[model samples]
Target: MSDSQLAKLPTSGMRRWQLTPKIRLTSVQATLADDLELRGEGDAHLSLVIMCEGAGWFRLNRQAIQHYCADSFWLSCASGRCQGYDFFPRHHFYHLLIVDFSPELLTLVEECGLRVPGDEPKVFSAALAEPLKAAMLEIQQGWNEASPLAALHLESLALNALWLALGQLQTQQEARPQPTASRLPSRERKRLIAARDVIRQQASEPLSIEEMARTAGLSLMAFKRGFRAMFGITPWNYVIECRLKLAQNLLEESALPLSDIALRCGFAHASHLTRFFQRQYGQPPGRYRSSCQQVRMAG
Candidate 1:
């Protein structure tokens, strides 16, 4: 939002409601009059925002994205050093829910392997699907209800919403076809390192074969062949393996929820993590966590 746009917002009737229900969930529900704007910047917490009612436009850092009601976005604190966003309403009224994940949750998400498919600090969903919408609604209700332990409900709701959003993104990813390997060029170690770094940075986002090849300074075929030959695995498999290892470490070391561990590790949900962990370690992540705890107690 520009300075002129910010000045045009109604001085009155734009109310900001905030609730710190739990250490992990910070909820901000706001209502703004048309042409009004909200601007903020921060690091240290991941944010999940929803334009729950009415249309709005927002810019996160340099990228401008518009949203309608139910449109959702997640912003990671680790990216861009610091993250910023400007929000302005297009309709007569705009309502939004902004949920910030605490540093602990963010760390858990990373450890559990919650990889999103983009380098951009903010990842947007054009519109949330039914599952995500329901979760959002439940959180909203929990936030509105003045009851003891409402924070607990909101915390669960936030995790559920996060999982749904991740699952939706995962579905979209699975629907897209993977790149086929092409003709190979001469192998180089530097290219392999460059490609590996790119994958690590973008593990949370979708894997882009073209981007990897370009970063590695190799042709598509050459990148594929060289990456596989050097790493003993294809680029995609290597990414998954790296994430799974991180998940294993979190499962053993942290008492964070499994769903959180799933997000951190880049898996869509706990079930997805379970399948992969079971395949690799002969037990699910929950079981692994339990076993580790048992061994610790025995020792």
Candidate 2:
């Protein structure tokens, strides 16, 4: 088959379920009521599942069932072992199946590579349910039929499905609504919230308490007191934390130069950035990048 066609099918080794450095594809299946279990005596690979309809339960390793209902999906694999999982199928529950794209996707991180940033695995999204469900159905059908190019066909569809699922997860995280406290005085709350938004929006700028207070329409002293009471941090500390977070993202998402990263994130200079980054992350940016690059290379 052609390269494009190959992209649609599972790599030849997929059936072994040894999704190692080579696989960048996701598998599919459905879930149902009751519990599913997977037993493993070894440790390796990446796995996950999403519940499209019902709830999933687990310990630390193993899943209860392989052939489940139309539940969305669940992801499980070796991170560490001596564990398992359990799920409660709702009255009408469904889920899908997916495996790791391998830790190797870190290679796609460009010249900089995936930063040695923390791995944050969040829940899959509801918005992707329909398309992903359809893709899983196709995979199921192809498997049952034992189609000539079953792996090839599933590969492309699975890639598209995974991309859609990840896209939804990203959007959901970015769109997470900040909580508001109704019990707090509205003016104080608005002012504090407004300051928080300003810090979030202009984290790279050298923001001062006075400036943030102005944005919040509160006097500087009042803003400081209210902010501390609300957020438990002085404005300067909060701003620095915000800038550090943004810097972290830039380091992970882009191959920007250290000098540029420092300036863009409002650090006094590259050396200053290095000091803070080292203290916070326990390594300088360059070192962290190299570490991740090494991990990818080894994989």
Candidate 3:
């Protein structure tokens, strides 16, 4: 698509880019004044949505309503045809990226001997990983560069995002059990979601399992069990993940000391952050920051 065509909805803060013949990226970053409904038809393509900031409800082919939040992602495959409806509440701020891969891209992936799951229409959502989040940020930052090579740069970044997303999808499918009716009631599920949001929003604060259980309105045992069942991770581990993610972002984006980052991310001390950061990212925070600085300087 041409640049003019890409910005058809400038008033709504929506922009699109044709990274390649078979790959496209669309971004929406806006604060809603009224409830918005986005409807679209899907052909034989796969779509990956990276939600950097926002919460919304969407359904594919009139399927069950699925909720998406900031720091999460959604993936959908349309083998033949599909329809999608996304609803965003009024007065909410949102920033999200939608990357679509045409059937030709899928063919290329298959030729490369990578199986693309789901022959029929299907959708999945999960928390975004720290590395994938960082990559998406890079894509956004590079999207508007006015260089002749910007298209090539964006194409490579888009493909990298797809690769990382597909890898995460494959891992989730292999590690988790198949879908079934949820055991938790809808109200309880909403409560659990609220509690999870608390962890995401308040990772830097002092948070406890008891407080999280109270937020979910469930007993300690029930909260623990249900949280694990719903999210595939324990509450405490999710907290640590959030903290580490914040630390990683700080390490890359700021020149703050490690101890300051640890405190800002709710770790007790620099050593505590170092232990988990190394276990999760395979490097100490100092080395990670140095490497990121080197990359920035070289770039």
Candidate 4:
């Protein structure tokens, strides 16, 4: 159906917000008197829908799926078939954030080695994980920020949400055995572990790669290669990962200011911490802390 036709659907209420030419974000808040059935247009696009607050059932094809508040669903709208949702009457309102993108967006995701699943248009029920929830909230809040940055933030958050969505699918499968890669020499391995331990222990203090190398008893180049072989990530990335994870745990468990958290996590300053935190998790430290706290309180 066209936009105008969709707006006239016999639902309680619906609204669509256009973010870009081919990208649309929608909000649906409906209080139904009966099972409200709605159908999709079967457009060739991708969609990420978050059930912010609601209880509803969606029937796509022959499958009936239930959704709760905080649940998410990813839709691949390439099939040219009608998709439907059934929302029951509720005293409280049901809210949804629907992010729709053109088929071209998948090209970008595929180039990044993160392909959204499903060939035909389908809705896979998702429970928005903590990190993804942060991204969604940031995108929502970004709407209030100034021009270019708001667009940029939405783009980043969309990609981050896609990555997390794919990751969630990966986690649903059972584990399988895989061929093991060759291991580093026993002594070299010990040295690498020792180096990692040193980094972990001194993450809150100023520590150098040279210090880590000396502790590992290897030259800098060798240390880098060996560490990558052992850890599957660069030594620098590993150091940042350690510090960030520490900072993340502290943020979740404590009520510390950014400056204090930065100092405790070995960052040069709160701004420095904010820069890397946003790079690593797509949000600043404060936003991440708030998202985590909200999740904690809800749980």
Candidate 5:
């Protein structure tokens, strides 16, 4: 893949690289001059698009128009003859990265026991996880490195990202309800989803279980039961997870003091962040930041 091939899109700048025969990476930095609709027709493949900074709408095979924003992503798998329209607003600056996995790579994934979502064409969106976000940023930064080993380095990063993405998809698949099993009522499920979104959007704030339950319009006991049944984790634990994810992103992307990062991510102090950071990621915040810096410098 190359910029010449991507010239059809209304991008101010574009770059594409073939990481391997089975995997290709492309990054686009664009300020659209007008509303644009882009289409695709292709053979079997899986694509993961990471929206680093942008807002757009896309639909596959005339499905619902799905909106994507900065710090989010969408994954699509098509067997053959897939069609989609990607719409970008006029004059909006957006930076996004796309990674395409060829059919051989999908075969390898299945051989490794991680099933692709389904045989039929499908697309889904989700919030990008901290580690995956870190990986994608590294790929973008290292895309033009002059080092002789850059290709190898990028291949490794691309694989790491694909693994993380597939893991998320698998988790989502497992969370879906089975046809024969009992399921949460639609109204209750929507409330629970709203409550979950609240945690994700406001992880830095001091939130209480009671407050979250109220947000879901359910009593505390019922809230806890329904939340756990639907999401497979306690509400409080989910809060912690959200906070930690924010902390991880800050550690990788910013130069803020550990104490400041801790407070920003809802931790009480630097030590509190260090404790949970170590338990979850096997390292302290300072060390993690240093490691990220080293990778950037190496690139």
Candidate 6:
């Protein structure tokens, strides 16, 4: 958000109300035989509910009680007034990611190959929830696994997670029309741009395969195959190679210790730094430093 815009946000007891650059998320666990009423105006591409305990009614009107177990439900609505009560999930903790976005933003997600045809929201179970949770968790655990993790990897995993959820939604209702390969214009170029931006910003952080896929705006399999074809190396390998190259430059020029150098270069520690350096340069960092010293002497 722009500085001025951020300043407009009420800081007074609204700790729960926060915003990410592109998303806003909220959660609640209320127990009441009472019916809840919601009257508001907002637009979003998707709203997800991961119920851990308890059950409640869901609908614009208190018309239906979606008997939700330990399952996930997605309510895909663009905008206008939406209401529901006990719409309350029966679970230990009701987790949710209510994505508030413009129609244009939703189109951007669609362009990124996220939403399947006729994709909507409804309650789902382990068969459906596990993969989405797994993908999301993978994104978290591997946030910095550049060679192992990249933005594309995160995006892909997120898509897969949503896809699994959507697939379940399909079974609940009629399937949405499947988007054809043609629907998404080849976005490899945009993907590459996103990758460059992400890599440049967090050169020291690892990028997951899923993140790379997301960056490339492609599915996991498609992103892998496409990234390799475009870059002449797998995305994961390319990321490692890129970080290693940066490390070498810093090691040769900076006065930082090997431990600091490793951390700065994205390695977990000095040892990781040495291992990759030796593998790529045919010598450990100590030797490489000595060699560089010799070169400087000759110069």
TM per candidate comes to 0.56, 0.38, 0.53, 0.47, 0.54, 0.38
Winner of 2 and 5 under TM-score: 5
* Runs with alpha carbons beyond 4 Å of true place in candidate 6: 1-186
lDDT minimum window of 10 residues, candidate 3: 108-117
lDDT of each: 0.60, 0.53, 0.76, 0.64, 0.76, 0.50
Instruction: Please estimate how well model 2 matches the true structure, expressed as its whole-model Cα lDDT.
Output: 0.53
Residues 142-240 of candidate 3 have per-residue lDDT tens digits of 988967699888888888988888777657744655332297788878888889998999999988676678767787657766777789776777888
Poorly placed runs, candidate 4 (over 4 Å): 1-15, 28-35, 63-70, 76-81, 107-119, 174-299
- Model 3: lDDT equals 0.76
At residue 242, candidate 4 shows an lDDT of 82
Error of 5 at 171 (Å): 2.7
| Error of model 1, residue 44, in angstroms | 3.8
How should the candidates be ordered by TM-score, best one leading? 1, 5, 3, 4, 2, 6
Q: In terms of lDDT, which candidate is strongest?
A: 3
Better of 4 and 6 by lDDT: 4
Give me the displacement of residue 5 in model 5, in angstroms. 8.6
CA lDDT for candidate 5: 0.76
- Between prediction 3 and prediction 5, the one with superior lDDT is 3
- Residue 109 of candidate 1: its Cα lDDT? 40
TM-score of candidate 6 relative to the true fold = 0.38
